[model samples]
Structures are given as C-alpha cells and as structure tokens.
Target: MRKTLLSIASLLLVAGNINATNIGYSKDEISRNNVFRLGSTEKQGQAMRLSHAKLQALKGKTIDFAEFVLGSKNVTDKKMHVFLTKQLDGTPIAEGTVEVKKALSKIKWTLDKPYTITGDEDCLYVGYTTEVATTYKVLMSDGSYDIEGCNYGYKDGAWVDTYGMNKGSALIFVNAENVGDYTDAIIAQSNFEGYYKAGDNCNFSACFVNAGTTDITSFDAIVEVGGNKTTQHFADLSIKPKEGYSFDLKDVDTSSEGEQSLSVTIANVNGAGKETDTSDNSVSANLFLYPKTMERSLLLEAFTGQDCGNCPGGHLNIEAAIKKTEKNVIEVAHHVGYKPDMFTMSEDPTYIFFYPNMSSTFAPAAMVNRNTYANVSTTPIVSATDVNSLLSTIYYADTKEPYVSLYLKTTLDESTRELNVKLYVLPHKTVPHNSSIFNVYLVQDGIEARQANGGDNYIHNRTFRGTVTGNAWGYLVKDIKAGQLLSWEKTITIPESIHSSYYADETKNNVEAVLKNMSVVAYIGEFDQNDNNKHTIYNCCEARLGESHKQTGFVKPTDVNSAEAEQSVSIFVSNGKVHAGGAYDRLQVYNLAGAQVENADLTKGVYIVKVTADGKQTTKKVLVK
Candidate 1:
C-alpha cells in the first residue's frame, strides 16, 4: 500500500519540473515516511504555505499551482476551500487570492491552460502567470457557474484518474460540446395556394427579411392516416440555395384522420463540434386536421344580436348539450354587431353570415343542429327534454383517427409587441374513399371575459378566432397521392380583445403564450358522409358518433327533478336497486375480492358500484343484510 501510494504521489510531479535539490523541512514541518497533516498551531518547526504574493516572484509561468499543503480539518470526506489569502508575513493583496486546487489534480487547468513552477523547495514556489491564474476562483462556488463540470466544460478534476480506492468518492463530469448553428428554414410560396384562397399563384413567397444564410434543399416528407396509405413526397435535391428560390405545393390532398407529420433529414457530412451550433437547417410543418365543408355544418348555430337580454338562457341550453355529448358539436355563437363580448371577432361577419339578409333578430334565437329554429321571444327556453333530444339526434364519428396533425411555432418580437405564428399543414394521405378535404381552425383557450349573463368572468372554452386556410366554402384537396405532404404558414397578430390583461400582462411580448394557449385544430373526414352511418339531422353531417354507434356511457346523473324523468333507468349491477325517487335498497353486495358480505332487497336508493365494462359485470355496495 505504501509503495502504491508513493507511486501515485510521484505521478503528480511527472508533468512539471521540480528542482528540490537542497530542500529540507524542519522536524515539525513534515514527518518522514507519512502523509502531511496540517494543524492550527504556530509551532517552532512547522513550515507554512506562503500566501500567493510571497511566492508570486517564484511562481514560474508554466508551473500551475494546485492546493498548498494545509493542515487537515479532520472532518470525514470534507473538501477544503483552497485560496491564496495571505503571505507567510500575513500581508493581503488584491487580485492574488485565487483558489488553485483544480490545477493540482491534473497539472493543467480546465481551460487547457498550463503552469510553470520555479524557485527552491522551501524558500519559495511560484506558478507562472497564465490565463488560468484566476481560474481557481471559478471552482470555489462548488460549480454553480461552469467550474469545469457537466453541461459545459471538462469533467470535475477531483474524480477522474483516481484509483479504485476512492471509487465511491469519485465525481462524474457532464460537459456539453459546442455545435454549429442549426435552423428550420421556411421557403417562399409560389404558385402557392395561399391561405384564405387569396395568395393563389403567389401564395408561397418568402416572408423572411433574409433567408438567414442558406436554404434547406433535401428532405423526405410522408403523410399517413391511422395505419392506412396516404400521401408521401420525397425531395432528394430540394435545395432552396441562397434566398429567393422557392418551392410550391398546390392542391395537395389532405383528407383522413388521426395525426399527420413531416420528417426531413440532411446528409451528415461535417460536424460543427459544438451543440450550440444551430446549423443543421431542417424544414418541417403540420397540415390542417378536420375536413372542410361547402356550407357551415354547425350542430348549433345560434343567431343572437347584441341587445338581446335573454340570450344568456339560450346560450346555456347549447352549452348543456355540448357537455352531455362531449361536444362534437360545431357550435357557432353568432352575435351580430354584438357589443363588449368576452369573445368576438372584431368584424362580426360570422354573425351576419348565419343571419344573411336579416337586419335584426330577436333575443335568444337559436337553430339546433340547424334542423329546427326556435325563438326565445315566443317559445319557452329549451328545457332538459329539448336539449337531450337535440344531443341524442346529433350524428358524429367518434372512432375516426386524426388525419391531419398541426404544429404551431410562434416568434415574439419584444420591440414590436408582435407575435409571428407559423402554421404547417401536412396530409396523412389521400382520403380512402375520396371526396374528402382538410379544414384548419384557429382556437384560443382560457380567455376570461365579462359576459353580460354567463358569470362576470366567464371562461370561454375552445373559442374559435378565425379561419386562415382551406376554403371559406371548403377547399377541395387535389392532385396529391396517399403519403404526400402539404404545408402553409401564416403570421397573425394577437388581437387586443383576447390579449386583455386578465392574468398575463397584455403588453409583454412572450412566445410561450401563443404556443401554450393557442393551437390550430386540424382534422379530415368524408365531406359527404351523413348521420345515416351514425346520427344525422336535417341535411347536415356531424363529426361525432350518436347513441346507435358503439360508445362508452358514463354513470347516469342522479337526483332528477322533473316527474317525467325516467323512474328506473336501466343499471347493470349484479345486486342493487335503482333509485328514481328516494329510499334505501338492501342488495347483495360483493367485494372486488369476490367475497359476498350481505344479501337483501329493500327500498330503492342511490348506491355506489364498481363496474367492469370489459367483463360486463358490476359489484354493488351493501347497505344492510
């Protein structure tokens, strides 16, 4: 063990020149044949490690100084803070008190700076001045800020190159390497079918002040729906070159269900050698999700005006239906020239479209599934009976997978208080049955605005802002085969109405808000499929399935008020009585462990039960034997 320890100690001096010919320590300064132990005592023969200034002149430029020999603190596994504080004469000096233990372990500092040692063994030892003279101070803070540890620099010096004896005490290093610049390039749209069907031939135009440096040219883009075939496109040499070059993708078929995506790869040639280098330059985008319709297909298109006082009641009726069915309903709350809405499109054109050619309308007027029209002025508010009927009648496809997947990248300019939202649209594939199109809707979540009736600060759920792509009358996706990709982007300014200061400072420019609260809902389905396959109402098709279609039902709500409520809605418990009114029912109870505790049939009352839909079995709780 002594030989091995001596060998390790000898290696520390191998990297530097040590001229200690006539050096001799006093009997008290160091004991022969034992490791040095520093203790707090001004003893007669004890030698002191001089302050940095005392050894400054002797510190050779190429000889880096590690920790000076100090007396041990005697605490187990305790690391000491090695600093060049005071000289042997006890004089302090600015810019000389640097920590240097890191230099001792490896003979070189983390920044690759070396040191030169000079002077006699005891008279003086100086570390040559290098860029790393003050480098020791960085390690003093236990590495809060890059003292050569993981995530940035070299591994911790204390652990590496140590023997197995200190294995448990060894420290690991996690440093990050520097990589070149990598960017996602956006190409200009030309012959580009711009959003709003407006850009037409010139929709795909470069919006960037400059293409940064170089444009991405090569990629493989694939679109899919479920496990079925869709559109796929490959660009082996699709380089954008410098700046002005653009690629146009027009009328690509984007019809299917259940999430589509675009994947691109660049040939791996040279590496930037730094993770911070953002030079990969890949281009990607997401397509719209839902299918577009020629005419509006809202399950509930409410025709309301600003002055309507009782419209709140009608609003509640529609809201209740949405909750009951999980709202596959396209509910358009059209308020013509409405004032001070917690949520409203600035133009109010949506309201006018539903009420085309009508100058005014009564309060609380609504069209349920657009199958029938009801006026709050004459008809009593829609009771639970009316709501349930409308909800049950709505046809929706609950099982279709998402054909379109959307990803939104937002850039916030602090100086301009403007947010740039780039939307990408890629199709899963061609609609299997054809006649399918894509629809993209911009939605904002968590808007707290004051509604005159529905609570002062009402939370508007999944409010639609406006449409940017597809046809106002539903654009037909064309010419693209299954597994091909189509993409478009738009930069929109967040309106001041939704930006009202409720939680976040309205004026603060933050990219996170747009990515977090705002999303583009993309979906695709058969534009002509009606409720005959599910549940359909008056010349319109719904996206969600109806009762006739297979579904998982929730436990029915209890405590019905109206006498017309079902006296005994069918339940599937092994032994439990139905509680239409009120009373206790003693029923056979079985625990989940398959043990029977009690059995009896008494009056009807509410009881909790554990249900297993897969096995079609339910165990009821026991009230009495």
Candidate 2:
C-alpha cells in the first residue's frame, strides 16, 4: 500500500485560515468578482442552504442581526429584503428590509423582534432579494468551496441549483447569540483509510471546528473500527471560536478482511466536559479491506493539438513531471481543443466537454485520473501552464489505493491484422453498475506529425488512434461484488492505413500502420452521460501488442469458484454453428471488430463467442468453416 509523505505527528496540526461562519465567501471567489454586478432588470436573489446541524446550533437562540457584504464598484442606494424560509421560494418565516447606499458596505438588519429558530426543519434558506438593473453588485464566493447543493439562485421566477453552474454564492451571514457559555467541537471534515489490505495499518484523521462560543483548550478524539475503540487525547490546543484543528491517528488495528464501519467522534471537550452540541461532533465512513493491494497506473489524458503554440511547452512540462515522479503513468494525447488534427479520433472532442466553458481554449490542458482537485477548480481540467499544480495533483493521485485489479491478455495475428484482447476484472469492493464503465483505447507512439510552433518533423507520442470499446464512454458493467471475477473478450482489427495531412500546405496523406508503435490502454472509471465532471478514472493499465500484462499482488480468493467454472465451459464451432459444452444462461457471437454477429449468419473465418452461465462468463475463439 502507498502512504503519504506527511509524518503521523505533523498530520495532527490545525489548518490555517479557517472560516468561522457556517458558509462564507472564499478569497478566490471574491477576487473573481472584483467589479461584478447583477446586470439585469429581472428580479434576482441568492440563497444558501443551511444544514440541520448548523440550524440546531441556533435553536432557541435569538437571531440578533443579518449582514451582507456588497461589492465595492457601482454601489448605489437600493432596498434589500432579507428573509428566512423553509424553502427557496416559500413564504419567509422571518423577513426584514434594509437599505444600502455605499460601495463595499456591510448592510445590517436588526429584527424588531428577535426570531428564535425552531430547530425542527431539515434545512433553512437564508438569502436576500434586490433590484440591480445596472449599477448594483453583490459579493459572492467562487462556489469552489466543498459545500455541495448548499447554494441556490433565483431567476425567471424559479429557484435553481447553482452548484453545477459555477456561479458564486452570495456573501450573507446570519448572527445569533448563544443561550449559554459552552464549548462545542464539530468534526467539519474527516479523512480515513478507505481501502486497506490485510495486515495493514488503518489511519484516521479529521478537522475539527470550534462552533461553540468559548475557546477549546483540549479534546478527546475517539475512533471506532471493527468493534475496537481507540482514544487519543490532545491538550494545549488553543482552538478559538470559528477556528479549526486537525488531528491524525495512525497504526490502528482495522486490517481485518471484508467490509468494516469506521467512525471518529470528538468527546470530553476541555478535559471531560460535554459540549453544548453533539450533533456535528461525529463522522462515519465505510471501508473495505482486501486480501491484497493492486498496483495502480494513473491515466493522464493530455488535450493538445498541432495548431496550439503552447502545446509543445505542455508536452515538455508533462514529460519532465513524469520523469521526476518515476511513477507508472500512461499518457494519451487527445488531438482536440485548438483544432482537430489527423490523429484526432471521433470521440476526442467529447473530452473537451469536461471544461467548464466547453471552449477551444481547453487545448494545452491536462487531466490526471479525471479527479477534481478540491484545492484547484471543481473540474478535473487544468491548464498546462500550471505545472506545479498539475504535478502536485499527480502526486496526490498516486496515494490512493485501487478498488479493483485489472489483467489484460492480448494476442496479435500477423496476417489477419486482428488484435485479440481479453480483460479480467477482479473487484476488491462492491461497485454500482450505473456509476462504473470499462473502456479500451488504442494509442500509437512515434508518429511523424507537423507542429505549428516546433518543427515539421515533430514526432507525436501516445497519439490516440481509436476507441475499441464501441461506446465512447465505455461498456457499462453490471453490479460487481467483492471477490467476484468478470471477464470480457473482444477483437479489434488494426487499420491498414490512416488518412491524415502532415503539413499545412499538404492535403490528406495515407499513413501506414506501425505495429511496434501501437499499444492498448484499458481503464475503468465512473461515468455520467451529461456531466463530464462526474467521470473519474479509478484505475488504468496498458499493454503493447503481442504482449501480455498481468498485475501483481492480486490474490484471488479461494472461495471464488467462478474462475474455475469459467475454464470448465467449452465453446467450439461445428458445421458453421457455435456449440457450448456446458449449460449457459446466454450466448453471443461477435466478429473481430466487436460488432455482434448472429449465429445463423456466421460465415466468418474467425469469431469470438461468449458464454455466460450462473453469473460467470467464458469467451473463446472459434473458426467457422
């Protein structure tokens, strides 16, 4: 298993610049909206979804005032309505109006009669409405914060979820006086060992928020896993109100096999005294321990094109970063963004959809493992100019353990030019069918291509050839269980020639296939048809033609009889009809190009026949006479 470079003791230190308020604007969001305004005549408003735990903290407490920070530019006198409602568009239970007159002004509204929170509602909406036809600006957070589904917008007479819109949240704060002097500790976020192998140490870490009015001097963190409890006491903490402290517990004994529940809770605030609120003091997560950990190879899909001048620099930076890390990283250069080149495949443009703007400016961008870096933008796409951030993200991705192991076996026919591929999937944890998909990509290296900025004889490496998986996203697999082995077999015919223009002055040219420069990349990731942000690569592996690739440290469970049963099944072609020796629930036949072929119409020289029985599958190659 891979571990982070941070020391165990250093991991317990508190994070800096903790936001005291429940939800506030971020500095990034503020800078982006230096002179922002709602330049429309239509009525518009911003609202934030307050969680039940945050609302419960103010239960029975008097809401003294509400404040809003307005932008500095084009500030004009306008009437603002502050309201607290159960729903975004529902009638407000508490309403107050305040007038704003200056720029960068903090508009405050003191309720004539203080409103006491009932604390019974699941969530509450706090926001304001104002008319800003031309010269009105409201400060908004960049919406890159961790809170999801907490920000909403009102436009066209309706409330909409603005989380995916990349629009900032309104900078609104609600104040309430606590009923009594009490110390409260809230577990704002926690990180625990998600995938562990047998005999490995389990680590737990969390960031605590001092939600209470009083300062937190010391606290006890109790971690429970697999019926075992371990408590770590921290003293002399000095965690003040609205501040945060983080702690880590390492080497805990949670290495038992199978699924386990892990929970971390803060108790004994300031040495054996109960906090005012315990609702947000605890967090829990489920983890699965496998018998062994598999090696992971990250996929870096670089979006580049020959027309992009900066793409050459992007390639240099990426190559340097990969060389520095010395990690097994598979690279696929997608010819998209600036302009489609000869190497561009049909599905290459779809990768550009991951950009927030979906613009051609996405060229010279790179995504490592298709994961969203919380510290970076919400989307996985990052500009290649930011080499430091890209390298950091790559290093961060290397620490995660793969949930499944992939094994690829390939064979190539010299005369027929057919590449037979067999993929075996061994899942260490349960994965949902809807969210996961398997993809196979064919990429070639050392292709002589013309570069706009570099040279005429510039060689492109790892250029995308075609998608062997039929579907652009991938072939969606069924629900997978722990220790279950699934297999798929397909044959892809290598094209004899490809039409592409090498130079700006030349027309389309025929490029011959280079067998030695070709390789197959297979990966599994989360899939979403509409949102590319949801597509996250879990694990990927690559194998060159005429070679076999197998993952080490994959110890299949002995109880899994399906692996043997798959071998027992026999498939052969007799009199141009496919026959199976064992009973099968379903049978299918496909030609070399992955298209399904009917049994009756099977006059092919070679075909792939798949037999499935009792939830197990076996595939074999048959020759039809």
Candidate 3:
C-alpha cells in the first residue's frame, strides 16, 4: 500500500536566502559536501531514497524546515513526494508532495507541522516519490564516521538497508536554545550518607549553579561529613546559566562506620562578592556506608531482537523477574547484534563505542548491571538455561544499597506536540569520582515486529529509542558530588509524521507509537576511568511516560513456558543442500553475520544457522554460498 505522506512543505521560503544548517555532518564530524546525482538525475522508481549521514544525531530534535541543494530539470510529472523514513524498516515519516513548473536552485521544503522523531534508527531518509518518472538531481556528501553513505532506496516491497551510498546537503533546522553567560551560583546537590564504613574515604560533592543572571566569577566550596571537613577553593568556575558544575570533596574519610552525615556549603559566593540569597548556600543528602557493602538494584541489559531464535528464553526469564521483584531489576533491551532493529540506539555513544567493547558478540546475552556477574568474563556470558539461577544474580545486586535515587516528573502537551521531562537525582553518599554520570533514555513499549524464534508477532519493550536530550551518559551532573541533588528539565517536540507501531491495533489511539509507549528511564552511576569495571549502572529507575494520557499505550510481555528451556535443534549444509537434523522442529538459515538468507541457491561462505524444536534452540556453522 503506497500511501501519500501528509506533507506541509511550502514553495516560497528563500526570502533572504539564508544557508540551512547542514544535517549531513558537522565540520569536525565530516566536513565535505559533494554533488552526487546532479541535474541529469531522474526517478528510477516511485521514490528516490536519500540518507542523511549524521541524521541519527538529530533523533530527539525538531525538524521545522529542510533544504535540498538540487536543480529541478525539465519535468513532465509535476507532483513529487518528499518524505523522511525510518532507516531500519524504511517506514515513511514526514513528507510533502509539491508541483514545480520552473527549474530552481537550493529547493526548500517546510513541513506544515514539525516532525519530532523518537527513533533515529539506521538512517534519516530525505526522499521523494514520483508516479511518473521525472528529472531531478540528488545532492551528496562525504562518508561520516558512523555511516558509509547517506542515501538509500525502496522498491517492490522490501527496503535495502544499504541500497546505495550517497549523501545530500539536506539541512534541517530545529528550535534550539541560544547560549549565554553564567552567573547566579546556588548550591544544587551532594551525596551525604547517614552511615559509612570505618576509615572509608568516601566520595562527596556539592553541585553549584550559575546561570546568566549574575556574574559569578568563582566560588569556594566546603564538604563536611562525619566530623571531618574538606575545603577546596575553586579559581575560575565560570559556569553557563543553562548548566551547573559539581564541586567535590574527593577523599573525605569517615570518623566511624555507625552514621555519617554530610553538608555542603558555598562560601565566597560569586568569588566573595555580594549575593541576595545567603539562605540557599548549603545542601545535604542522606547516605549509609556499610562496613562490607550495600544493596544495589540490578540493571539487566538484555541484548535481544526478533531475529534471535534463543532470545525467547531470555525474555521468559526477564518476564519472571518483572513479576517477581520488579524494583530489584531494571531491564534495558538493546535490539542489536541481530537484524537492524527499529528501536536500536546505535547512535548512543555508550552503545556504538562503549557497551559493545565489554559485552559478548552474541544475541540473547545479558550484562547484569554491566558488570562481571557470577565471576564470568564480560564476553561469553554465563549460560542462562535456568531462570532461577539467572534470577539469583540479583541477590548480589540486591544486597548493595543504591548510592543514588532518581525521581522523574513529566508533563506532555498533545496540542502543541511538546514533551517535557524533569529529572531529579538524590545522592545517598559522596562518590568522589570525577567520572560520574547520569544517563536518561526514552523507551517505547509494545512494538510488534518480526522475531526469529518467537515468530513474526514478537513484541519488544524497554526499547531504547534515544536520549532525553543528546547526552547518553548525561552532562557533568556527577563529575563533582555523589550525594547532591541535581535537577534538569528538557523540552522536546513530539513528531507527528513518524511511523506507527507494527501492532497499531494494540494501541488505543495515535498512529505514532513512540509517544504512547514512551517511558523515561534514568540511571546515575560512575564510569571507571581505568577501563576496568567501566560503564557501571549504579542505580536506576523509570517514570511512566505521557501524563497527558495523549494516546498512551504499553506492550506487555508474552508468556512463555518457564519450566522448559528452548529445545535443541541443528542445521548442516552438504552438496548444496541445507539439512536440518537432531530433533529439529524448525530450520532457519543465515549468512555468516546472522542475516536471514535464502537456502535454495546458497552463496559460498561460512554461514550460521539456528535449529529450533519446541522453542529449544542450537546454533551450527556451515559452509554455503
């Protein structure tokens, strides 16, 4: 069903001819724009697929306007379809079909309504569809660090994820905040526990705020706890009004392990200058430093996808965990390492560059709190055949008191298509590490997509759509103090043109599932600078999204048999024939990297396949073309 996009593009906007902000790539990211299929180009199909190289970075941003640096040649078909589609599934998002009589330079298309994208999937497609093939030139640019090319195509029925490599100078402008100076310094938050280990040199910090209202040159900070005081004089902490800085007490030892209280005071306000409010200078939070250790909630980073045959078992265990002790676990399902997923956050710094460095290269694998669970290697995760054993790992995590507690408050305006997220971080103890960070992500629930083992009707949840603001690990909220209260507010637009959920019937209203299924998840933790035990999710919590109840929906997990594991199945290829053996109930073939490939006329290469019988699974390597 080829549907025309609900477009809001205008033909007249070049009043003064201002240069559009190039959405392809930044100067440092990739600084070159080349003309690919220029003036002589014409539509080869109904739609000419275009990919913006760095479009994923604009995931949570607003797209009010866009520019296409192209010249329209002599065209018979005046009607054109200009649109944006999801990179993973090539689902059309925003678009405008307009007619042109004369050729022009630097054509511009403005959406009547702004498009707010939640899933900045594989690509940001800027394309146009024409029923009658017409002449049009498509712009191009250099390959970015993240993408090989910047354009794509959709024909017949299926979409080519990497159809062709091309770039375009399609500049998309969004409503952004202008930067200003920093002034008004106020005490924000600190991590002060009530108790601590004897002789424990705890991490303590005080967060300071200086927006542009005042000219705060510098400030002196003092962290006192357990009858011990640590004073640090900050020289030039010129902070921006839109941001705050954490001042710290790195190694403050506790007098004893019984009870440790902390208070953070800011003297020399604005570098000893006069300030109106002396009352908001000091702040403190509670913490308990146990003699041995404290209980911390387990963060289950489940790497799953519909294409993973064995992932069903992992889901069963996670569902059990959710039913058993939901608070004891915070599950984040990363839909990668299989097929290109609609919810995979490949744009995330932690996902693209960090988490993979420490996790296994296989699906159905999990990182329990992003740490070595059961003393197993980060790679080759311990077997998860037993749900009880997998559930028991939380015992260790449950024993540790969270060093931080996060609270969330959100207000959504459906009429204006605006989403406002408010985050509050309360520190329990001073974690003096300089590399502390808080990551808040928006997740969608109940996406009915294809799955390898659970059939094509698998539902995905806790799917990381993108970051709240652009920060995956958040800003420098934890760089200075552990037990301080850090508060932040982010306003993002909800795009109307994005794709709807696969199972739209399951949703009560709203075609776009992101807004309805969105959930705000926050985690305040520390990263080990030494690369050992790196990227740890200390404490985590979630806020139910869409208080406005504006087309709200949630995808519940499907029930699977927990008493039995996925049955064993095997596959082998011989004499150009794929064979399924060993109690096999289903035979699924894939190329070496795990993409589903046809079995009839096979290619010549090492291929991995899944053999499943009665939900049981096994993998085998074979040589096929």
Candidate 4:
C-alpha cells in the first residue's frame, strides 16, 4: 500500500560563473555571493526521503501547507532543485528573493521512484532562498539526486517551490475512413459478422471534420486488430500525444490470421514532422474496438536449430499449432540449425539466411507463413502433420491487396548493446520491374529453453532471435518504389547474453523488457532475388504477443467444495427456499485470488464449501449446512 508520486520540477539558472566543484558543500556553501550549480557534477550524493507532516486540527483551525515528499535512495541523476538567495531576513541588500514563478504553484513533490524522470534535462531542482536554511544537492550525470528545499514564503509571494501534477498527454488514431455499411444502421460498427469472440462489442465514430489549419490540443483514434507494431502502438492507444503518433505494420503479426492491417496516424504535441492540417476542423470519431473473432489465424514458421534433433518435432508442431489454434495460430520459431540458434544467433540473420533456402538439410523444418515443403524431401524432417497440412492449405488462400507493408522504428542503447532499427517497405499495390529483396525478422520475447525432449522446459514465445537480411532471403530494395515507400536502418546488439541476463535479471526483468516489449519482424517475400509472386505479395507476417494480464486481487480459498458445496447449495437451492423472485438472492464464495471465502446473508440454506489454490485445500458438506 505504498504508491504516492507527485512531482513537477523545473529550475533553470546558471549561464555564467561555471567551473565550481567542491563536492560535499560547506565551503561557505561553495563561496556564495550568488550561487546556483545544479546540473551535472556527478549527481551529488542522491538521497531524499522525508514526509512526516500531517497534524490536522481543523474546525478549530490548524492547517499546514508545508508539504515535502521527494525521493531517490540511489542510482542518482539528482533532480529536486532550489535557489533564490537575496535576503529577506539576513538583509542581503541586492535583488533575488524568489519568484520562481510564485514558487511554481506552491511546491509539492513526491515520488519514491517510478515515473522515471525523462530526458533532455529537468528532473528536479528548486531553490528559493531568503536565507533561513539554504540547502543544496543536485549533481547528475548518472549520479542521481535532488534533496534541497529552502523556505521563505513572504505571504505567498514566492520562495523555494517546485510543485507537481501535469499528467496530460494523448493522441491516437487507428481506423479512419471505411464508413459505409452500418449493417442495419449504426449501434456499433468496425465490421465483424458471426464468429468473433472474447466479449464482442464494437463502435466507431470519427469527426475532427478537418484540422487543416492544424493546432489541435488533443486527439485520439486507434483500431488495432492485435499485436506488434509496438504492440499496436503501446497497447491499443489509450491516447498519448506529444510529438507522438503511430501507424505500425513492420513484419505484420497483428495477432495474425489473414487480411488485417489498418493504420491511421495523427498525433499532435505540436505535430512533430509537421503537415497534418486536414483543413481547419477535422477530427471526429466515436470509438470502441472489442471485436473478437476466431475460426482462424493460422501460420506457423519454425526454422529450428540448437543442433536440431528433428528440432523437437518442429517444437512439437509449433506447440500443436498453438493448441490447435485455440490460441489462434501465427507461431514463428525460426532458429535455423547447424548450430547458432541459441535463439536466433541471439539477435538475427534469420538463420544464416533462411538456412539453404530452408533445405534444413533435414533436421526440424517448418514454414507456415512462407509456404514450403510439399515435397522438399521429407525426413525426421518437417512433421507436425506436415506442418498441419501446410496449415490447412494456407488457411484457404484468398486474401490480397497487401502485398507487403511493414514499417518499424526501434531505439534502445544500453550504452550500446545498441538496438536501432528503422525499416519501412510499403507497397499494398505495385511491384514489378525487378523487385529485389527486403526481408527483416528479429523476434525475441521471453526465452527460457532446455529441451532435449524429456527434460522438456521450453518457454519460447515469438522466438526467432535474429536475421537482418544476411540469410540469403532478402534485403535489397535498391532503387525501387512503385507504390512508393521504402526505408532502411539497422543496429542490433542486445546480446552480451541478452545483456548479462537483463542486467542480472533486474528482479525478473521488465521495463516492458526495457522499452515497449522488444520486437522487429519484417517480411516482403520472394527473395533470392525475384521469382515474381507478382504485383509482389506473399505476406504471412509474424511476431505476436498477447495474454499477460495479472489480477490476483480477491483471493479466498481453503479447500471448499460440494463442487463448491453443490454450487453454493444450488444458489440457495435454486432460489425457491430463500424465495425472493430470482437473480441470486444470496450465496458467495470467491477465490482465484479474489478472496471472500464466504458471505452468507441467507434466509434459506444448503451449505458446505471450501477451496484453495497453489497449495491445495478442499472440503464439502451438504444442503444449507
């Protein structure tokens, strides 16, 4: 029960008298005649934790506005500033008493770390003195700090301030323009008919009408079908605008199946690369994206390696086509054998270039998303029902108009285990005139290996460690832009053994795996330099993720049963005994980490129950007892 963070620090001053370093203060507080040095001096001893002041006594008057709660117990970059010493009590004579914007809304900072003070500068520093007790400490260059709060409020005029609260930023847009068939006149639409489950409910409305003159302060619209493209722009855009906008598709895997790629980006925090004026007033939309459909989404690509012994039955037929598509298949394993696949050479080169065009020379083969085999001389070779009947004949073919449209921009440089990728290749239409190569794939999410079959273990997901065109498959968009759109950039290196096991497993590693869940999966098909899949398109797209929700809230189990006491004595014996009418009158027992073992305010009985989890517990008595 410790979650309290409220901080907003901005202190700027010091364009002159530089060169000052004494470290632990008191040299007359660094020879003050007017001093303010808080900007990189190796984060001066970062340590801040002070919040003990709340002695309420109102009605008889006694309210205190003296609140201070700043943080940092280590890993310094110091930020919590203050400085405005110009005599109000010690009569300093010259100016500078402290207006720092009237103590910037009454200084009130607090954050025991985890909102992580961002870049370009300004994390914390607020100095405002009239000299009563001018403290100091803010020296950062990765030395982390901020512990200086002086006071002198001259009747709320200004002194020692640095307040908080400004969590406002959102801009998202997903589906725009596809508004025709309201299928029976609106109520909800994003077009989905019959078989789509997981809570089915939908809506879509858009009308900014035009922002041609452009200068919107807020905007949002996102209709992501599933995952990747930075997990559909950081998880289905709950809106975030500040030089921020997204339209992801690189190496498509919107939780895969067939035909689903919609992108409409429009972000504005002062619109970053400009040009968004949809003419004065255009931005309108009613929204909702809970369209859950299932019946198909199968495509399993596992090239396999780690000295393939039939790559564990092609990793058990891509884990039985993801439990026979209950998880709706779009599985990519791609290790590419003859060694080096400790998870895609750790980063990529998609198996030294799709391993002899995936000849696998026979050892654990696959390709559901790239359509292969059929005859390629089978062996202990490629068998998961022959990759599930080549995934039921490419899920019944018939999905076009998206030859290949992938674009991505990744950035991560843990002091250079550097992960810099910027790849784009959009061509929903138009290709011919020697369409070269451009295939990018690098998928790594949660790697846990150890399977010599029998020792089992295998926790691999979206795992295909690396491949940046050095695998003979592709990477040559040389002078070609028919449906125009091509880009390239690469810089990977997060393999110092996955960065020393994620900095030695930073307590189960997560900063969303250090920046929005690692991803890089690009595909443009038919490379070995053109065999013409015509108008150019062979998309099966991979790199997927979804299903990681944790809510162990209510918990209440100690082995209770009758099947949970005959379903709580048949809901008070089918409600007749308790007689109220219907709709559950009483009977409660919840657990699955949602506590509340029992709550009975009944009139009719029929009891006996018990349940427990993770340890094991059970009990069951009878009718209302």
Maximum-TM-score candidate: 2
Model 3, span 1-625: residue lDDT tens:
1111111111111122233222322111122243334222344222222223222323455656654433343444655566666643455677776664443343466787777654345445555543423333433232221111323433444433322242321222222111122233444333353334456665555554442234455667777776678777766544433234665575566545434567777787665555433454677654565434333456776666666778888788767865676555767776665544444553432552333354445566555655545344543133344566556555544544455555565666667666666565555456656687677777777877667777767777777666777765576644545434565656676666333233234333232545667777777666754563555566776766654211111111121122112212224465566766335577778886668977776768887777777666766677764
Question: Which tens-of-lDDT digit does each residue in 392-445 have in candidate 1?
Answer: 444222222233333333344444434433333333334444555454455665
Sort the predicted structures by lDDT, highest score first. 2, 3, 4, 1
TM-score each candidate.
0.27, 0.71, 0.39, 0.24
Worst 10 residues of 4 by lDDT: 180-189
Instruction: Please write out the lDDT profile of model 2 over residues 1-625, one tens digit for every residue.
Output: 2112111111011223232222332222234344343435445567767667656655776565666665542333467778888887678878877777764545777777777778887888778776665544454544332223456666656776664344544566666554445566655435564546767765556766565656678777888877789888877766656455767764467556677788888899986645655665777877777664457789998999888898999999889888788888899998887787777777777777777677535668888888777677668888877778778868777766567778876777768687777677778777754668888888888888788788989998988777777666778876777677877766667878655433353345545679889988999877787876676676789999878677774455664345645655656565678866546898899999999988885785889889998887788788887
State each candidate's clash count: 75, 1, 38, 93
Write down the worst ten-residue block by lDDT for model 2: 5-14
List of clashing residue pairs for candidate 2 = 29-142
CA shift of 51, model 1, Å? 99
Model 3, TM vs. native: 0.39
Superposed Cα deviation of residue 480, candidate 1 (Å): 5.8
Candidate 4, residues 1-625, lDDT tens digits: the string is 1111111111111112232111110111111112232322332211111111100100112111111212221212222332211233343212222222221022332222212112222112222222212244211111111112211122233222211111110000111111111100001011222222234332222211111212223333333344323221222222211111222223323233333444333333233333322222222221222113212233456655555565666676657655654533455565544454344344333333333444434446554444333354222124443656544534432222224444344555466445555544544334434545666655566565554552445655666544655453555554444345555544445544432121344343221232234465655544442221222324434332221111111012232212222222112222222211113334344434545444444334444444333334443333432
TM for candidate 1 is 0.27
Arranged by TM-score with the best first, the candidates are 2, 3, 1, 4
